[model samples]
Target: MDLDFYKKQALQKQKEHKKFLDGLKKKPPKNLDYQVLETHEETFEEIDCLSCANCCKTTGPLYIEKDIERISKHLRMRQADFEAKFLRVDEDNDKVLQDLPCFFLNDDNTCSIYDVRPKACREYPHTDRKKIYQINNLTIKNTLICPATYVFVEKLRKALEK
Candidate 1:
């Protein structure tokens, strides 16, 4: 799919989905079935991620202390040097890169340091996992960054309704 088309679709879906979620919050579902349905719907409609690594290109992952150490060590650099050069702690106290389109992301849209990338980077979409309910907030965030989240939620909602 075209990147621009998917980007537009994702943005439109996000707005609609947010409204749906807001409504659900006002009058929460009585059972897990409803939540599952909503998720399925969102999932089924999402765009493919490989075609557009917008998340990697437009945002940085939160790097924990261990990730920072591991990645820095892999780069043959001191932990402090790595932090000074590439990362900073966000207001939420999570270490994140200072800029988007991550420094580790290569021109081909692949992670240059995939083996030692941050935990959050490794778990980008967080939609393919079995335990969907455990990370609703994370899923919501992924909705903005990943088209896969949109597709995953759409599929989940359909399954629930079935």
Candidate 2:
């Protein structure tokens, strides 16, 4: 999906969808996980993230210690050097990329550190996980950043309504 288009759509839909997601959290359907998994699978089938690495361009993964260590090792750099070069502490005190357009993101929209990327990067959009309600807030945020996630939630909203 296009970034500008998705941003507009997500901005318009967020209020209604947030209310709906809140209801799901309050009384989740038993088939919720299964439904979400199907949506996630189908969304990925049609969504090629390489075409639009908005997540890498606009935001970044939260780097855990393991991520730092693994990435440092992969690059043959000291952990402190890696942190100093690539990361900064965010408002939440979590280690995040130093700036937008993550340093490891190549111009071709490929991640330079995909294999050793952060846990958060690997599980992005987080739509198919069990106890999905637990991440409703995060999913709400993701809709603006990831179009496939927006589609998944919209599909989910329609399915539950029926």
Candidate 3:
């Protein structure tokens, strides 16, 4: 989607999310995991990530030691060299790309090192996972980055109201 479209959707989703959270706080429901997963599945059916790689273009995942080693090996470079060239330690002491539009993201929006990508990259959006209610903060962040997450929340709100 275009930047304008994304901006509009982001604003709308933000309002929806606040309303949904407020409603939940007033009358919380049981069996939230089933509700979230069902909504996620339905939303995923409609999302097309290839059309919008906003996350890869706007943010980087925290890279663990294993990710450093694996990705370094994939690039045929020493781990320290790889880290120096493409990453920096964040305030939390985790490795992340130096800037937005992660270095590994190709022009086509595909990961250049998909096989050895970080754990966080592998679990992005995190909507279909079990225990969805436990990561409500993550859901909020992902909703801002991933259209699928926005769609999931919208569907979830509908489901919860039923």
**What are the RMSDs of all candidates, in order?**
4.4, 1.2, 2.3
Residue pairs with clashing backbones, model 2? none
**Best by TM-score, which number?**
2
**Which runs of model 1 end up more than 4 angstroms from their true locations?**
7-48
Model 2 spans with C-alpha error above 4 angstroms: none
- TM-score to native of every candidate shown: 0.73, 0.95, 0.85
Write down the lDDT of every candidate, Cα atoms only. Answer: 0.70, 0.90, 0.80
Per-residue CA lDDT of model 3 for 1-162, tens digit only, reads 664565568677786687676666566577776777778778877877777889899878998999998889988999989989999988998889998888778888788888888999988889877666567677777777787787787788778777
- Whose lDDT is higher: candidate 1's or candidate 3's? 3
- Using alpha carbons, what is the TM-score of model 2? 0.95
Clashes of 2: 0
The weakest ten consecutive residues by lDDT in model 3 span 1-10
The C-alpha local distance difference test score for the whole of candidate 1 amounts to: 0.70
Candidate 2 lDDT for residue 130: 86
lDDT of 1 at 145: 63
TM-score of 1: 0.73
lDDT of 2 by residue, 1-162 (tens): 578898889999999889989999999998998988988898889889999889888888899999989999999999999999989999999999888898889999998989998999899879889878888889999999999889888888988898
Model 3: CA > 4 A from native = 13-15, 22-28
Top candidate when judged by lDDT against the true structure: 2
